[model samples]
Target: MASTASESKRVVIVTGAAEGIGRGIALRLANDGYNLGLFDLPKAEPNLTAVANEIRTTCGVRVSTVYGDVSQEEDVKRLVDIVVQELGSLYAMIANAGICINRPLHETTAEQSDKLLDINVKGTFYSFKHASIQLIKQGKGGRLVAASSIAGKRGFAEHAMYCASKFAVRGIVQCAALDYGEHGITVNAYAPGACETSLLTGVDEYFSERKGQPKGSYMEVFSAGSALKRIAQPRDVANLVSFFVSDDAAFVTGQTWLVDGGSVFD
Candidate 1:
């Protein structure tokens, strides 16, 4: 069993907590009073230590950091073990570590496709696996939130591999929800569209190159395509995640909530 500073406090583990939507979710959960176990790649930028310190000081919650690639099985196990050993119990798991490779279906190599699937699909599965075991051992209800994408719901021209990986993640979330619900665990996913983050910067370049347009023009056109006529911020997606793991969302499970500002309504 993990050590616990306070047994009554809720504990959460967030993968990819170094930046973008993952970072936003971590901050929001900290503000909501959840003691955090943050996991990220070893050389992740944006300084996770700074974020952890901010949360600890501002939220007055215990914060732990684990450095590892979410796609690696050993790393995933280590992350969960650290959280369970240190926090004493695991209440929620957010599998938000993902990577994207933008290329036409024919242009994507087998290696590239496999890498995307490994990181986005298998990485998420490992997170769920370890977190579920820890939660069951703790003998308490738990929450599992995976990060799917709007691409998972609808395919884009150059996002074939990314879409496939996200679709698999959504499928996993649904299946896990059904299986774990019997154990009082709620599993769900969030699908965000065109979020304004560094991750989308590459997409802007890809579209600009394909269309022979300037980078700025490509993003403007893309934003206008959305019904909201704007790109989403990381915080917007984070807010939805915060709600899903909260007590208010206890009854919601096995669903994919879109945080796309009406980009894809089904």
Candidate 2:
């Protein structure tokens, strides 16, 4: 079948594409016939190239992987350079790299807070900055989809720093959307709820140690607060991101779509 204009062969960059939600988004975009440029740390889990190869073989789109820390400006610039050189042009950028460290506000050290802000907030800023500049240079506009969190919409206990970072992401996306609208660029964010990923592994360990329970035993406890009473999968969040990056979502910008299974209704 012939692909639509939005689904046509276009260059797309996905940060944190080594695993979890970022990996899912990369695969989905590939299935829609997007050439892929995946960025993540060199030590990222799940072997980014393997996932990229799988997409290439299965979806029949070119895939490239660049190892870099999104928090570093030089690294992000290198990533964009690779995408432009290898993929020809940039059409979409998904800023999905993030870290979560849940702890009481008092227990959260200054360094930990700084690292969280660096990766979650500053990293996203760098992604948007480089990708938007490249898209503007291309003179075709582009899509910018960022990963916020349900924590951004509403604060969670013992997650003060994480919540603050995600809230900052939403604010940034909104402002960028308004600023870039005249240029035909759209910026939006997804607020995903609890998901089963390595990011949560530390939280699980923390809870198990604190509550005297098995690591996975608290999955239900954490999910019960949501109206759906089920934790979301990474693909669930990825699917929403896929939609937002498509032409169908051109009319939708500066909006925060919550995919937490009704965890944050507002």
Cα RMSD (Å) between model 2 and the true structure?
A: 1.7
The sequence of per-residue lDDT tens digits that candidate 1 reaches over residues 1-266 is: 12232346788899999888988989888877789999998787457888898898888889889999988989999998998789777899999999889999999999999999999999999999999988888777889999999998989988999999999988999999988998889999999988877788878887888889888675687578888888888889888888888778889999888888777887
lDDT of 2 at 186: 97
Model 1 scores worst on lDDT over the 10 consecutive residues at: 1-10
Q: What TM-score would each prediction reach against the true structure? A: 0.94, 0.95
Q: Which ten residues in a row have the lowest lDDT in candidate 2?
A: 1-10
lDDT by residue (73-162, candidate 2, tens digit) is 999999999988998889888999999988899999999999999999999999999999998888888899898998899888889999
User: Which ranges of candidate 1 are over 4 A from the true structure?
Assistant: 1-7
Q: Give the alpha-carbon lDDT of every model.
A: 0.87, 0.87
Per-residue lDDT value at 27 in model 1: 89
